[model samples]
Structures are given as structure tokens and as C-alpha cells.
Target: MAELIDVLLFAFLLATAFYVLLSRDLLAVVMVAGIYSLLSAGMFLVMDAADVAFTEAAVGAGVSTLLLLIALTATGRWEKPAGHRVVPLLVVLATGATLVYGTLDLPPIGKPDNPPQVHVAPHYLERSGEEIGIPNVVTSVLASYRGFDTLGEVVVVFTAGLGVFLLIGGPRRRRGGEK
Candidate 1:
């Protein structure tokens, strides 16, 4: 039953990812991108990572999509790629090849005995309560170990909002060729 559910979720994520990448219309692309985020959040939920799911649901499914739509309204719906260039394509292919090579060195999925999980998480779960005084390990990890990084993420988001508002929300500027 669990295996079946995992297969279905993976299929959904894959389909939505394809839709996001292959959609012709900008609005459709944006909608599919939002769906991709939602599917990712669902995957996180299934993996027992509630904290990650929460962030993905809020930021990926909600805030980022809204910001993208706002920017789309400010700019235009259609994207012009100018011209297809081989240099960028080659770079992308090289990077992707490197990533695929790196993945070969990773531990296989769902190994009964994974070294990192066995060694690291147990230690955190065991001593976190005594040192951090937090019963919830996830909350402690977020608020302590990566607290500053999280704060910086929020600051970056706020800055982007300010930028979009300044660029799009203000009075229209006179065109250069206006009489």
C-alpha cells in the first residue's frame, strides 16, 4: 500500500514537472509551476518531513506563485528568448552531466542501514532535549542550528517584495517618445 502511494505521488510530480517545462502559454506555465510546488509539498509530507512540507506549502505553493503572477502582470505574458545559442546549451549539459556523476556517489534510496541517518539524526534527537530544552527536534533544528540562515531567507523575500512594489506599483513613467 505504501509503495503504491509512493509510486502514484512520484508519477504526479513527474507529470506536473513536464507540464511546467513544456507549457506554451505563460499563464499555463505559471499554474503548472504552482502545481509542481504543491506536488513537491505532498512528497515531503509522505516522507515524514512535516517542517519541510510546511515551508514548501507556504512559500512554494503560496508566496512565490503570487509574486510570479504579480511580476507577470507588470511585465508581459509572452517571453522572447531572442535566439537559441549553443554556448548556454553546452554549459547546461556540462552541469547536468556533473550532477548525474555526483549522484552516483550517493547512498541508494531506502537502504535499511544508511550511515548518515544512523549516526547523525540519532545524536540530535537524543541530546537536543537536554541542550536545547525543546521537545520537538524539528523546531530546535530550525530555530537553533539554521536560525540565522532562515532569518536571511526572510530578509531576501522582503527585499524582493519591496523591489516588485517599487517597479510595478508606482505611477506610470512617461515614454521616451511621448509628445
Candidate 2:
């Protein structure tokens, strides 16, 4: 059942991605992108990463969709034609091939002797309660053990939000032409 769900979700994701790539209308593309984000969040949930799923749903589906809609309102809906596509297509293919090749180095999921589990995870599970005094192991790992990484993620999100706001938000009007 789980495998079936995963297959279905992945099929939907591929279909949505193709639609997004082919669609000329910006609004339709934005809607399809939102669907892709929601599907991604669902995949994360299936992998037992509720925190990541929540972030994906909120940032990818909610905030990103809203921002894209605002930007679309400012710009035209249909995409404009470009002079050349061959070079860009080649670059994209090369990048995709590189990414696929890189994934070949990853260890199988949930392997008992995985480096992370062997080295880092056990120490965190054993010491989190004592050192961090957190009742929940997950909370301790996220808040205390991996605090810098969590903070960096927050900073990146905040910076992206600020950039989007500056892009879509026009300058404020002055009353009575005052400086």
C-alpha cells in the first residue's frame, strides 16, 4: 500500500512538473507549482519527516504561491518567446546528468551501519536527555544538537522573504508630494 502511494505521488509529481514546464499562462503555472509543493510535502510526510513536510507546505505551497501570484499580477501572464533554446536545453541536461550521477554515491536508506547512525545519531539519542534536558529526543536534536543548522535555515527563509517583498512591493506613496 505504501509503495503504491509512493508510486502514485511520484507519477502525479512528474505530470505536474511537465505541465508546469509546458504551460504558457503564468497563473496556471503557479497553481501547478503549488500542487507540486503539496505533493512534495506529502512525500516528506510519508518519509516520517513531519517537520520538513510542514515547512514545505507552508513555504513552498502557501508563501511561495502567494508571492508568485503577486509577481504575476505585476507582470504579464503568458511567457515571452526567447531567441534560443538549444544552449539552455543542453545546460539543463548536463546539470541533470550531474545530479543523477552524484546520487549514485548515497547509501541505501535506513542502513544499520550508515555513517550518520554509527557516529552521530547514537550519541545524540543517548546524551540529548542528559545534556539538553529535553524530554523529547527530536526536539533536543533540532534545538540543541543541530541548533546552528536550524538557525541557518531560518535565516535563509527570512532573507528570501525579504527579497520577495522588495521585488513585489512598490515604493510607498508620499502625501502631498512631501519628501
Structural similarity to truth (TM-score) of each candidate? 0.78, 0.84
Per-residue lDDT over 59-89 for candidate 1, one digit per residue giving the tens place of the 0 to 100 score: 8989889979987897788766547778988
Question: How big is the positional error of residue 80 in model 1, measured in Å on the Cα after superposition?
Answer: 3.2
User: Could you tell me the lDDT of residue 12 within candidate 1?
Assistant: 86
- Model 2's lDDT to the true fold? 0.91
Question: For this target, which candidate reaches the highest lDDT against the unseen true structure?
Answer: 2
Per-residue alpha-carbon lDDT of candidate 2 for residues 1-179, written as tens digits (9 for 90 to 100): 98999999999999999999988888999999999999999999999988889989998999989989998999979999778899999999999999999989989987989888899889888888789997778778888889999899889989988997797556765553794
Worst 10 residues of 1 by lDDT: 170-179
**Candidate 2: residue pairs that collide:** none
Model 2 ranges with Cα > 4 A deviation = 158-179
